[model samples]
Target: MANDPTHQFLVNKIVPIEIGGIDFSFTNASLFMVASAAVASGFLYLTTSQRGIIPSRMQSVSEMSYEFIASMLREGAGSSGMKFFPMVFSLFMFILTANLLGMMPYFFTVTSQIIVTFALALFVIGTVVLYGFYKHGFGFLKLFVPHGVPGALLPLVVTIEIISFLSRPISLSVRLFANMLAGHITLKVFAGFVASLGALGALGVGGAILPLIMTVALTGLEFLVAFLQAYVFAVLTCMYLNDAIHPGSH
Candidate 1:
């Protein structure tokens, strides 16, 4: 099972519990998610605990992460969006830590699950909807109505816009889930090849070198993809929030 590319994604109950027909069991995915949250919180707390004139390494990393997310929100949604810094920063750190932790041997990748990713995406879009309506009321609907469209084609454009708006969560979730799933699968397949080839004979051991190299390269690439996907998720969330803040802007 360990050699199976898809086996790594299988969810197994660590502590099964049932309540009135609801199965609320703790699983590997849940464990990793809790771990990710803890790691992010601990890192931030430890790094920022001390005040320094010249920053320590941990302090520098903590400050850089803070500034990076701050700048992203400012650029995407403007200064007003800074109000969402806590949520956006937590989202970024959680996902980033989850991705990095999943790279470790025998660790579960929580974000690789569609349910987890979709939940996060839904939360993002939900925030946009809630804040948009709360702040702008019916004016938020103008977000679906692009400016300067001719009246003749307005209905069709509105329909297209509605579909696009509805699809945001699906696209956002699938992008992260698919990338992690595919990358891990590829890594596992190459790793399996290396193990299988090396177990054969001297000639097979020599052949294993190529797959081993590929696995190494793929691991590094996956690390980059992990961070990039997290950044892309954060940026998209900011853009969506921007639409809520200033509806109908081109």
Candidate 2:
């Protein structure tokens, strides 16, 4: 099963419980999700627990992370969007930690699951819609109408805008899910080749070197992708929130 790439994503019940008719089994994915949150929280707490004129290395890292997300929010949505800093920071840290954790051998990549990613995307868009409507009342609907479009083309443009608005969650979720899934699968395939080639005679062992090198290189690339995908998710999230903050901007 270690050789099977898809087997890594399979969710197994760690503790099974049933309530009335619904199954509430604690799964590997659930465990990893909790672990991701815990790890992120712990890191932040430990790093910033002490304050000194000259910050410790960990403290520097923690502060940098805070400023990074804060700057992103300010740039994307302006000062008004800073109110959602906690939400945005937590999202970035959780996803970043989860992606990095999954790179470890035997660790299950939670973000690779479409359902998990979709739920996150849904929460983000749901927040935007609820907050937008609450803040702007019916004025939020103005988002679908561009400022300078010709009257004849306004209806078509509005229809396109509505469709695009509706597709945000789908696009956001699939982008993260697909990148993680593809990277991990490719790594597993190359790893399998290394194992298979190394098991044979001297000639096969010699041939294994190339696949082994490729696997190592791919692992490094996957690490880069892990960070990049998290950043992309966070930035796109900020853009969406910006729309909510200023509903009628072009």
lDDT of candidates 1 onward, in order? 0.95, 0.94
Candidate 2 residues 166-248, lDDT tens each?
99999999999999999999999999999999999898899999999999999999999999988998998899999899999
* Residue-level error in angstroms, candidate 1, position 187: 0.3
TM-score of each: 0.98, 0.98
Best by TM-score: 1
Q: The CA-based lDDT of model 1 is what?
A: 0.95
Best by lDDT: 1
lDDT of 2: 0.94
| TM-score, prediction 2 | 0.98
Model 1 compared with the native: what TM-score? 0.98
Candidate 1, 78-193: lDDT as tens digits:
99999999989988999999999999988999999999999999999999999999999999999988999999999999999999999999999999999999999999999999
Model 2: runs farther than 4 Å from truth?
none
